[model samples]
Each structure stands twice: as C-alpha cells, then as structure tokens.
Target: MDPLTPMITTNPFDDDKLREECGIFGVSGADTASAIVALGLHALQHRGQEAAGITSWDGHDFHTHRAMGHVAGNFDRDEVIRGLPGGSACGHVRYSTTGETSLRNVQPLYAELNSGGFAVAHNGNISNAMKVRRELIRRGSIFQSTSDTEVIIHLVATSSYRTLLDKFIDALKQVEGAYSLIVMTPEGMIACRDPLGIRPLVMGKLGDTIMFASETVAFDVVGAEYIRSIDPGELVIVTNSGEIRSHRPFGEVHPRPCIFEHVYFSRPDSIVDGSSVYSVRKAIGAQLAIENPVEADYVIPVPDSGVPAAIGYAQESGIPFELGIIRSHYIGRTFIQPGDKVRHLGVKLKHNANRALIQGKKIVLIDDSIVRGTTSLKIVQMMREAGAAEVHMRIASPPTKHSCFYGVDTPERTKLLAHKLDVGGMQDFIHADSLSFISIDGLYKALGEAKRADGRPQYCDACFTGDYPTTLTDQDDVVVTNQLELLAERVA
Candidate 1:
C-alpha cells in the first residue's frame, strides 16, 4: 500500500467521538520486562485499540514484536513474551491520528543508530513533523515509515551531538507539540515528557524495577507502586546496572497538560496531574447542574463515559439517577457493517434505551461532549422513541469549537458542530428540548480553580478555547500550500 494513502476504519457509531491517540509503557531492571509491559499496555487499552508493539534489548541483540490489533490476542501468549527476552523493554498501543492504520505504523519504532540500537514508544502528535521531515529529506535522510514518530528517530540519527543523550535532546528541541515518550537503547531506558506537557506520563516501581506508563492505572494493573508523574521537559534514564539519572534539557516553562483527559479520554479510575479523574468528572457534573438546572424526573447518562457525571448531576439536582440506556458489552470492535442498512442500525446494536424505565418520564441525558452532534441527535431520538415525555441534554465539557493539534484525532474545525453553531442552534439540530454545556469557567471551577485566568489558563483547554500552546508549523504549511495551489489554478 502507498504510505501516503490513509486506511480509514468505518465505525458509524463511534465516528462522532474524538479518537484516542496512543499509549506507552516501559520497564527496566526486570527479567520479565516485556511481560510486565504487556500487562501495563492491557490496562491502557482504552487509549488506543488499533495496534500494539514491543521492542526489547536482550543484552547483545534487539528483539521486536508488532501486530495490528489489541494487546490480548497478540501479546498475551507465553510464546510471544518468551521471544522478547530482555531486562529492559518498551511497548506502544496506537490509534492513527498522524499515520495510516497499518503494521508499518505500529510503534516502538526501532532503528540501528551509530551510537547503538534505539527504540521509541511515543504517545502524542508532533505539530511540526512535516517541516522537519522536509528538511531531513533534503539532507538525504531516508524515512522507513510515514509516521511522525519516525521523524524523531531520523533526527536523533542525524544529530551532530557527540553523546546519545545530547543527540536525543537536540532532536526534541527541533519538534513542536505534545509527547510522552518511552525510549529503549543498549545502555539504558529513557522516559521523558515534552516541555509544555500537553500529554500525560507517570512513573512507578516494583521492587528494584522501574516502570513508566501513560497513566498510573497501568501501574496498578501490574502490581507496581506509583512513584510520580514525569515532570514536563524532564528526562529519567535508568542504566543497565539499575543506576538512575534525571536531566532537564529544556529550560523552565509553565506546563499545560490536556484538560480533556478528565472529561473523556482517561479511564475514570486513573489519577492525572495529581487529581483523581473520577472525582474531577463528578465535580464537573455538579458544576453543570448548578449552571443549568432543570425540572426532570430522572437523570440518565449516555453510558460508560457519562456515568460518573450523571451520578453527580442527579445528586446535585435532587433527581433520581437511573440507567435509562443499556450498553451491550458483547459487541466486538470488529463487528461488520454489511451495508447502509446495517450501518444505520449500529447504534442499536451497541446501546438500547430502557423503554419501561423511561416511559412517561422527563429525562435529562448527560454526555461528555458533542462532536458532530449526530450521536446526540440519535440518542435524543431514541429516548423519545422509548416514550420519554421530555429529553434535555447536558454536556460535561464546554463547546469543543476548535480542532486539537496535540495527539487527539478530532474532526476539522468546519466539521465540529460547535464551531458552526451556537448553543440554541445546536439544540435545534439535535432536537433536544433543552441543550446546555458547562461554561469554560465552570469547567475550571470543577478542577478547583475559581475560573480560567485571562492569559495562559491553568491547563491546555485548546479544544474548547482555541488557545493552542504550541506553534502548528505543519498546519501552517498546509494552509500556505493550499493557497499556492489555488493561485496556480486561477492563473491556469
């Protein structure tokens, strides 16, 4: 297949939701390091579901295993883990936001550098990857994969710095955007986060072994003690002999971690940025209730992602909480949609309204966010079909008016419902009796802030506020290229 051509997965039911970026896990100073990394990746499966890969340095040689699917089917087998014999290993689970969904893009992307063998597992987007790629190509750097992650490897390979650590830091300095990376080399394992820290990464320990993962919840899965988050712009290196070192190659800068993790991306059980995700979500729902109270008989969640907030909303609004929608846990991720008829019935296969419970009831539906508004409209229509007297919609997060350049796979600015429509217009489009979203200030309040401060808010709320923390050099280049093409067309 052509590397430039995108291989799109058609899932009508999930298309309206923002796609997860990726997950990374690493372990050093353990005999069964690859096995432990597999367990950590299993716990972080929600972050990415399309593909998984692991790379291990077994004393003298590097061993790698990669597949296009979930961690269970590919990595759980005894034979697979035994093949990756090493004391240090790093793994990645990926959902393609910057590359095609293929085996070639599955990472823990590895290379044989002049210094030694290097493998990297990254969990974020590089905003300036294309600009750097063009420059590298001009300088005779041959790229093996179309993934932006591969750009880091090439940069490190071509750097003029004398030491591997300095070369790694040099490569990082040229890139823009979020990254939480776990890198494995012959000498040691290196874990680091980008300067602005738009993504999340945490450290943990089990006996003498040190582990790194995208979330603390991964540590819990593998029976590791939570250490702490890898600080923004900080690099932690664990040597072959268990000696550890810390470096801050990037100077001090205010961190701006992604705020959406609390709203939707992260598992509720995970702790992010020293805050419980479940607690933050519940607080967000309570804030939503205070800002948009309504007369309703029952408060219902959209299910799974919306449950914690729904409970908080019901408690705050003095309404009974009920599971008005039931989700089918048996539905497989690869369930086939034979045709348009089957595709249109996809929502029913996954979620069905509780007709008996919701009949003749005034219900309020709580959801994380509205992307295209298609899912919200269908859900509201389903509630009405179940004999709901009234259906009101409440969103836990503020309007997602802008596209995310940092890792998340969001629809374009024009495709987002909030970007094109106001609150009233969105309500009309969804056919909801009432529609409301938590104000940006209310969202911050839920996170224990009075409100969002004037400039440089506490977190990276770029998707909601259109205030990107990094320079989008790639996106800017695309805009310029498009303008040039249009001008050439006019002249022709």
Candidate 2:
C-alpha cells in the first residue's frame, strides 16, 4: 500500500490544525455580570469548546460554576446563570490539550488567598509554568489542578507582597510566556497582558460597565462598544466604583501579538490589534495571488476558514469565484460515533465536492493553511471525483513548520507534514497539480507592514519563523532530562 494514499493521509473528522488556547471574558460594574458573561462566552465559543467556567463577585463573596462542555450546553440555562450572582464577573472557554481534558483544569480557577477570594480567567500558556511549578512544589505548595493557570494562584497565595495588586505583579514578573489575564478580586477586576503580548486581549464598554475579552467579537455579542486593546506589558485595574487605573509595570519590550489570530483563530468580523480580521485575510489572499498567479477557470475556497482568502484570490487573479465545494457544519462530533473506518470515509459527510459547479472546470483552491496535509489530500481527491480538470492549491499563510508553545495545541514536530516535507514533496503527497504558500514577507505585507523585521516585529510568527520570543523553559527542561537519562545509562 502506498504510504501517501488519500486513505492513509486523511481523516474525515480531524482538522489536523492548531487548537486555540482559550477565550476569556469579564465585565466590571455591570448589573447582570454573569448573564452578560454567558452571552459573551457564547460569542467566543469558536475559540474553545472542551470546557467553560464563570466566576462572579458580589461585593462580599465569590460564586463559581465550572463544567466540561460547550458554553451553549452548560452556561445557557437561566437557572445556571442565576446560580452565579454578582455585579462583577469573569468567564473562560478552554480547549484542553489531549490527555489533560479534565474538568478540574477548567478556568476561572479560584483560590482563597490572604486577600479574600481571587479568581482568574486566562487566555495563554506560561512557557515556564512547569519549571516554576516544580520549584513551588519543592517549597511545599500544594497543587490543586494540572493546569498552568493554577501556578498564578499559588504564586499569589505565597507572595510576600502586602496587597493583591502587588502580588499579581510579582507573579507576572516571575513567569514567562503569552497571557491575557482577567483577574477578579473582592475590590475590582484586573486585566493584564504579557510583556510581549503574544495573545489577544481587548477592552470594551457597555454603558458604565467595562468589558475585557479575548476578541472584539464578544463585544458585538454583548452590545459593548469597542474601546482599544490592553497594551502589552500594561495592566488596567478597574475598581468597584468604576474607577480604572493603568500601569506599565513590566517595562518596555517589543510587543509581538500573535499573527495567527488574523489568519484563522479570530472570527471574520473581529477587529484585532486595530485591524479587521476579514480584511487581513483578504489582503493575504491578494498577496498570494500577486506572488503565485495561476491560470484556472474558477477559484474555490475550502469553505468557512478559506472563504475570505479565496475571495481575495479570485478578485486579484481575475478568476470567477464559485461554490466548487460545499461544507456541512452540522456533521460535527456525530461523525466520531460511527467508528474509525466510517469516520474516515465520512469526511464527505462534512464536506463534499459540488459536482455541478466543479465539473470540467480547472479550479484554483484557496485555503487558510495546511497543517498536516491530510485535509488537503482529501479535498483534492474530492475535487477530482467531482470531475474537476485541475486542482491548484494556494495557502494563505506560510508552511507551519514548528509547533506552538504559547497556549495553542498543535501536533508534535514529527507529525507536522510541512516539517517533514518540502514544498514539492507536499504537493506530491496532497495530489495537487500545483501548490504554493504565502511567503513570510508576503504575510507581513498583507498585515500592512513593509516586511517582518528579523529582530523586532509587531506580532508573533513563531510557528512559521521558529524564532520564539520567550524561553521555552518547560520544553527545554524535558529535553535536558531525556539527555541526562541517556548519559546515566551509558555510564552504567
């Protein structure tokens, strides 16, 4: 059997891409904080679906509910919303990594610190969390959950600082990685982004209440007016009386927000980092067309994720855009119940080639990315089966050659098809007539930059460039441990 066969390379149910870290939302000074948080979390559900949580502080006590499931199933009921009562609240939607998807790791993780109660909703991964966790444990700190977010709570609990704000600042100074945090204390709500701002966090307003969310789309969902982003290294403290204070205690550094948000993580309507996500994607597609033009009868998107780029490609290339492929979003999760073989064959259950529109047409297929190359293989096969004369593939982003450590859950380096193969090899493996990816410079140009600065830039492109801004202490420690064990065996 050929190793590169479509059956071997594809999975009908698997997207083979990076999963978003988490989405965090908070509202301070709102009358119905928890209820408004539910609506906001529902809007940001696309960010995560594995688990959801919300915590509310009503002047005296903090109330919380954490569950493993979509926000729609777990947080939509009026009774559930009523259980969490307060004028200030925060919530989180998480996509836990495989083998770590337990309810105990759900966010809005709470603790009874010396300063009353403290709860935090986090939207990033701490690269040095495990290293800090080991040290904290050695110092006799009892752990509650396996999540990295728990580290912040323990850090706050043990801080020598007198005030809650000081303790939080102490914690932020010690750890490293991407984080956009919404922390709730008895007195007020605290929102802060990491020094480099590798994650997205925005501030909005609904009347007198202040809102903090991972994206601007949540503001639209909850009827909030977009304000501006919480600048990297900056902290904004919102008091119970609606008093807001801003501080830049982390000092100055090159703020590198995640570029992937504009490419795929954020909703099309979202305005992230002062630019429209849809507009960035369209520009990416246009750049791709200018960089890699091909003659075809029609241009077709892979659907949903690929639509914006495809539209830009079609317009820029002067090719007619048509519905060459149709997607069935309703076929989610249900495909897993039919067993592996059925699931693989049923990739068509979710996406099928539009035979009528595609027949005899030479088409250019546009997609946001190709993670493991599996979906591309299947989509190309489906196009051929639908009587398409030629299928030329164009990717909106550069090949994702490195796995992400800043909260995004991605396949290991060995499993990444792009990391394992060159461009020609990928084209052969995916069975496309021609394949091209937007150059890294092209990607930056689409984001309205002349080109990404090699040493300093506006956003994190670590997945493509492999030039990580922070020290991956946890990952490096694991590698060191493995090397030590190998040396010990050789000595024996």
Which candidate gets the maximum TM-score versus the true structure?
1
Worst 10 residues of 1 by lDDT: 1-10
Candidate 1, lDDT over the whole model: 0.90
- For all predicted structures, in order, the TM-scores are 0.97, 0.96
User: Which window of 10 residues has the lowest lDDT sum in candidate 2?
Assistant: 1-10
Give the per-residue lDDT of model 2 (tens digit) for 1-492: 000111111223756666686999999998889999999999999888778999999898999999987898798899998889989999999875545356778889999888889999989888888888889999999987887888889999899999888988999999989889999998799999999988999999989999999999899988899999999998999999999999999777788999999999999999998999999999999999999999999999988899999999988999998888899878654245666656566658778898998899899999888888878899999999999999999999999999888888677777788899999999999999999999999999999999999678768998988989899998888889999999999999
Error of 1 at 18 (Å): 0.7
- Backbone clashes per model, in order? 0, 0
All-Cα superposition RMSD per candidate: 1.7, 4.1
Model 2 lDDT on a 0 to 1 scale: 0.88
Task: List candidate 1 segments past 4 Å from native.
Answer: 1-9, 97-100
C-alpha lDDT values of all predictions: 0.90, 0.88
